[model samples]
Target chain A: MSAQDLDGGSDAEADGSGEMPKPHTIRLELADEPGQLLAALAPISDNGGNLLSIFHERGNLTPRGHIPVEVDLECPPDRFERIVDALRDAGVNVIRAGAEHFGEEVMVILVGDTVDSDLSDTLHRIESSADATLQDLSLSAREGTDEASSARLRLAVRSGRVDETLAVVRDLAAEKGLHVVEPLAEGSQ
Target chain B: MSLRLAVLGAGAVGGSVLDLAGDYGHDVVAFADSSSSAVDPAGLDPSAVHDRKERDGVVGDADPESVFDADYDVLVEATPTTLGDAEPGFSHVERALADDRHVVLANKGPVAERYADLRALEAESEGTVQFEAAVGGAIPILSTISDLGAPHVTAARGVLNGTANFILSRMAAEGLDYEHVLAEAQDLGVAEADPTFDVDGIDAALKFVILANVLSDGETEYALDDAEVEGIRNVPGTALDLAAEDGRTVRLIGEATADGVRVAPRLIPQGSALSVTGTQNIVQLETKHAGQLNISGRGAGGPETATAVLSDVSRLE
Candidate 1:
């Protein structure tokens, strides 16, 4: 894949094809070095897939401080998922992996003393409660106190689960004194 | 999350887009031709047009407002190249933009004719109108020109169309007339039913307009009309002739100079990356520091065009 840039990666405008028979777009973050693309592609090829096209944007890194790659391949709809598991076994940071239309985007704000209050727990709760990925994040810490910090989290929630995610955000905010900016509504602004 | 896409035009290009979008498994709202653009009051599919219906297919909705009725993050435009014509499909696109949906267009007309208006609405609504497939499908030509960057993109040029190049290459190789070669292309779904844009160089010109608009910073007096577009119809006998005579192949190039840009057929030397770019699409961008960077790939079809659209989705992060 490295020798040919024919491995997985995302380029939005395309006829989604893949090495596997069933088509899915897997977003991965890998160490910026040699053979990373090859390592990712191996799992898909081994499982099921025809090498459609891979856009391993070496220049564009993912949220995990690694290159964000998108792979489009074809595979049996039933067997298409094993490739993702195989990729995980291969020790790649599978940030966001799924059939193209499965992930939903959600934005939430975390409030309260995040630094002192173990912010990792908040993130975990979101994932567990909402079945989503923390696609992007921006945090603001005022002065040196953990009591006054906030984070803007842009999440890729599983599709049709936007309500579930909003419910989780509401619950977490109520539990932790956090404030959430509801998406695109009147007061959400 | 799966994106619910409804392609309003199911031509070769639009059909390819629908096929690609459907492959994503996100609910393909519908795949209908723009001429039959409609919306269902009760959740109609976007890809339904004419008699081409399958099991569980939602027919066209009488109105196109359903595209905005529910919600869609990305709206793909793959209609024909009809710039400046107040077509219903163009109105549908405008409606999508007004509804604040991100758009990935492979359609040539709206971007070429209404770039400034579209740019204004994009800024006002914070929605993105990415036309990567519009200019050169799967070639990343828009990205290449964008790589030219602000204040740095002084000039540019390229072999923009793969379909045209393929026809010309075959004409040169087999010594066939235009009609024969074009008919073969039409049969294979490479050239459209009406191959005026590719033959007359309007397609390249429209794409050049998009490139100039996206890359340029100031209000330059650049217009698609300013382009000196000359097609393969005028070029005498194969690129092979040009290659042998000038040691280069005749390539349909969209060259943008400082304060001006033009789309014309040029002679590219043998062993050049542009020369090596076979089949449907290829792009060569001469940047300020990059100097002669070439990106070649599928320009048309479901997978390649969809790949270009997928790139736009990747950048959403």
Candidate 2:
């Protein structure tokens, strides 16, 4: 893809109009052979998909002795289907293909009785209400669940939704009597 | 350009002003410490007043109210800060302005809690209020805003509280709990015996509230109640550990914009400009054309704050 296409993707997203490019992840199983990886990737760029990343599982093999690969690419909503169809038409085993458009990562620490407040339910509510996905979470309950503990949450949110997502987290934390140490806003540093 | 001064309050800041006024070519004509006053038309000796205050808990035999009647060109309100009506501090400024005399304030109460009232009094009198010492002790935050013309400055944010910063930085560096670091800070004299105003973010919030008032330039008025303040009291050591693991550290940062003011414990990058260590303070001003200007130094202390108060007195001259 041309450099203009990549810039065009972000520009379209910035203006919040037209058919913006959406990031999608594809899981594929390729045979352990020379050019198998290159052959699988050719269909994506050929169908106007901008390659974001390629997670080549060289040592990871499927039950059938095939290498499992995960590819992240960005393209318009309509072109995404064509890219996936082209991959399948090339005789590549498409394990899964779906859109996951998280463009920003926000880190926050919630301090309180995180466990006693039903953390799973809190996480579920954040995901559904804030339109964010819980990417990673590290809980430190050294003082036991009975005492106050801190949980570091790394959330993946849509671009420009950091403030809205944080507001939701703040509301949730307030309800649970937890304190949230939010990161400085983007570009503030 | 020497000026006659009347200093109110005999606390650290007030006493420092009285001690350093002569060095700045100004004479202390009147000095008070709530209960007593020392007044002389020809100016009073700084050391004599200090000695009297040290020996007998009082500055002089004169009544505190008599300070207003002294023949001074500027009144320095260095009293302890109070919330709401801002009490005697607010009254002191009013009396100074009513006398058509300039007033320099090192008190946050009158400015943070009664900005509009102070401005109205300034408008009705020949005197003008300059409170560079009220916000960041020695950082010159308000003066910088004044120099840039408040309209050109959009926002101000920084580590405004030394006590809170000392406690947080100590906790982060030593991996100690909040209580432990706070006790250590008290021992080091970085934090006061009752640090609720600092640790609970009230002190920082008051500074940011003053900043918001300056940035608004009378278009808006911000008081302490208008700020959304959150303290570092709830920030456990594990929270700092978690932030450190991710290449970040926590600080009690206060932000003031035309929109509003908010002071809270925020996670900033470890080596960023806002991550000031110990009792140091930093103020970042976002100007309309100047990008961002950072002014950092000791945000609190007797002599450091007195310098700010003296600078205000010089401006009055």
Candidate 3:
């Protein structure tokens, strides 16, 4: 998983790095089909991730016409990073990942030419580099064109790691010439 | 292979159902009661299914919790009746249905009261709500006659309440009056402390409502207050004497008529199926295309009703 490439996939095979249990969560979308769920599970299970529980809503349809699945799994500390990397390589959307110890709750918004700029790349950068979790997302492509559409991402990030998350979002928006709309911090609020 | 099992409400019917469903190699989930006496034994093993006092899969610690919110594919509603008190017992069933869980209910009072609401909910969730034990005790009435559009049953009636019919049957056979027969039934625990629903036509009337709603493909609304009810309160010499001329016996017939459903005595044919339905027994179902379909068997005992429910549960897959 490169810190630069945005399409998330880094490899295609199980170079098993394994995982240790941590309290991290990720949200993802996949095409609805028989093997999609199994493919998603592979990244966690093959990497030595301990499955706590899985909430598979087969009936609830996601935006991509797929079922929404929430999996809570445990991974070992030693192989956690490699497990995440393997997940990215397998083309499993590593929407969010962290070694159970990192990440806390945070809310942020960026203003810019979101549609014109590659917003998907920006989100991937934050996850791969900033140690934050995208908890929930609300997007408005109201301007309709890909160049001007904007999206709001609600994230669960490592506690005290909000600055790192914001830094990535800020830098990406600046590079794409998009505006940033962020929340108030310590004294500002 | 083996599976998990649980029995909620360890009363007469629940006890019986647990015994039967457990017979097949399923590990008992736990025996549960409203008060739940078996909460201390952690992880009640599957072997407990055979314990005469033990029930598998109830709401206690030693038992598997009936977590209505969690993902369990099946539920069986076997509870005693509370004619109008629509809480925990029957309402627990409502929760099960809401979660889209499969259900087989032996309890009739709740269906009599909440069938329409539950049916709509099931339809919305795309789940199944079956009640084979509601009306005809051990009789397979619900499955036998489910053509709610009336192509199957243009008109139908039943000798529904077996307990009441049993009491009436004894009076006709022994040539006794109401007091002696009532005393005999009470000693046998056939009637309840408040005998209004069973005798005053409320019980049979509610069954009447269930039949009418299912047969008409309508809703569950018992304008029961409007129904003309005539319970056997006293024995009259002329009534007993009427038997001499009619050559026919008396029985409680819950009839769904053209104008409205009614429960009363009608002179049935001498060798009619319903007339031969005997003590604590039932025979009543008629289909238009299929003609008359008579189902007769023990209609009121707990074990029989339990077997009725478990039979449906086993056949679900």
Highest DockQ scorer: 2
Error of 1 at A138 (Å): 67
lDDT of 3 by residue, B1-317 (tens): 44343456667787676666656544334456665534212324433533534444433444334445333455667766656543455666667667666677776666666656666767776447667777777877766666434446654466777667766777667756556666777778887666767776677777676666667666335545435554544322223334323344456667654445766543343345666434555545556555566667777777888777766676565
What residue runs in model 2 are displaced by over 4 Å at the alpha carbon?
Answer: A1-98, A115-117, A143-147, A186-188
Candidate of highest lDDT: 2
Model 3, position B84, has a per-residue lDDT of 59
Clashes of 2: 0
TM-score versus the correct structure, for each prediction:
0.55, 0.82, 0.54
By TM-score, rank the candidates, best first.
2, 1, 3
User: Which CAPRI category fits model 1?
Assistant: incorrect
Winner of 2 and 3 under lDDT: 2
In candidate 1 the C-alpha lDDT for residue B238 amounts to: 28
lDDT of 1 by residue, B227-254 (tens): 7676765443422342334344455667
Q: Comparing candidate 1 with candidate 2, which one achieves the higher DockQ?
A: 2
The 10 consecutive residues of candidate 3 chain A with the worst lDDT sum are A4-13
Ranking 1 against 2 by lDDT, winner:
2
Q: Give candidate 3 regions above 4 Å deviation.
A: A1-189, B1-6, B24-28, B37-71, B147-150, B219-228, B234-237
Q: In candidate 2, what are the lDDT values of residues B1-317, reduced to their tens digit? A: 98999999999999999889889999999999989999999989989999998999899999999899988999999999999999989999999999999999999999899999999999999998999999889888888888899999888999999999999998889988888888888899888899999999999999999899888888889999999999999888888888898899999999998679999999999989999999999999998998999999999999999999999888876
What DockQ does each candidate score versus the true complex, computed on alpha carbons? 0.01, 0.41, 0.00
